[model samples]
Target: MSETSDSRAQRLAAESLAAGSPTAWFETLYDAAGRGAAEIPWDRGAPHPLLAEWLVQHAGEAAGADRTAVVPGTGPGHDAELLAALHFRTTAFDVSPTAIERVRAAHPDSAVDYRVADLFALPPQWRGAFDLVVEVMTVQSMPRTVRAAATAAIRSLVAPRGVLLVIGGVLPADPDPDYGPPWRLTHAEIEAFAADDLALEALDHGPDGLRYRAEFRRSRLLADTTSAIERTPC
Candidate 1:
């Protein structure tokens, strides 16, 4: 039998990890999918349910005239499209140029500003720039070596009083070293988003107990000990 998409993703991730470029395989995955050699395992063709519900609950506060939101690792652009439909000035990005190109092609007249950007080296103006950020499954995709950097990048996306929402599978305290391209997040890892000036406002477990939804907010009033990183420019 030919290689399945899941197996292909795993093989690519393993190869990329060994090469010291953990995220490099994402481009290859999208490229193969475009050529019909593979499918993207995570392209569910709908907004993630947990993220959709959160947006519904906050609908009144969610839409705004000049407010902006960002979605990282927006593979097929579902969540980003939904945010745009709800009237947010949304920017969505993926490191893979093929993925970015595909999402753009998928929505030629879309309001979302789709870009190819690496989360690790985002533009300096992005620091504390967005009024809201919805990150789903992105951080859990990173290896442990980049966990701090990943959380910091996510944290820096929110402006003061802005919100950061996360949704991901819950991993046990310790897991097998070879577990995933999505290396499911530990509770401590999720809590790291609150380490800087961001406050953990809500944390809920999905009914199945396998998933987590977390909400964080940066206080409009700066904390006395807040570092420049927390004050956040680049």
Candidate 2:
């Protein structure tokens, strides 16, 4: 016997709530998403509002640059599409083959290139290739031990004069040691995480100053002029 629409919906919702971590949920989604699932709840359907707003505000500045944007952990490609629409040559990746397949099918003609790449195992050819590195709720999904490695991988993607934008959510309190794949990063912790060669350009914590947007710019490249200037030995 076939199930009713409402019954199927109810069953899926129940399964999701019981899934616990978002990562586990993604695994479930990968299996169920098929070749082309129209509506995944985590999709958010449209472009990310914060990113869209920034693109609109910076349209003029971005238009003149030849920049490549990399979206790590791009599940269903909403954010990648948004970046491409804004004129950035964007590429997005996820470890899940199913998720990558869905994204590629959805935007077949788009400039966005959806590839399957593990966060840490990015192709060497892509190293230092992006002018913009985006981490949208991706890093927090990892265990604490690998967080540093994840941060390092993101940093490596940015060119000397590039930027990194990380959008992460917050938990009610400190995340329970038992509950995760959606770790909450404190503002201080984030600052420390990206402290070495990147500096915060703009950080908005919003009303509560926790769940937020953090933008980091790679330290300015030391130009060849430094050697030229040193010849004078003043």
**In terms of TM-score, which candidate is strongest?**
1
lDDT of 1 by residue, 1-234 (tens): 888877888889989999999799999999988998889998889998888887778877677558999999999999999989888899999999999999999999999999999999999999999998999999888788888898899898998889899888879656795678788887678778885678776777877777888878888433422221211010
> Candidate 2 residues 59-117, lDDT tens each?
76455247789999898898888788767888899877888887888888888888888
Error of 2 at 54 (Å): 2.3
Q: What stretches of model 2 exceed 4 Å from their correct place? A: 1-28, 35-41, 193-196, 208-210, 221-234
Give the alpha-carbon lDDT of every model. Answer: 0.85, 0.67
Deviation in Å, model 2, residue 232 alpha carbon: 47
- Alpha-carbon runs more than 4 Å astray in model 1: 172-174, 220-234
Q: How does model 1 score by TM-score? A: 0.91
lDDT for 66 in candidate 1 is 88
Instruction: Give the top-scoring candidate (lDDT).
Output: 1
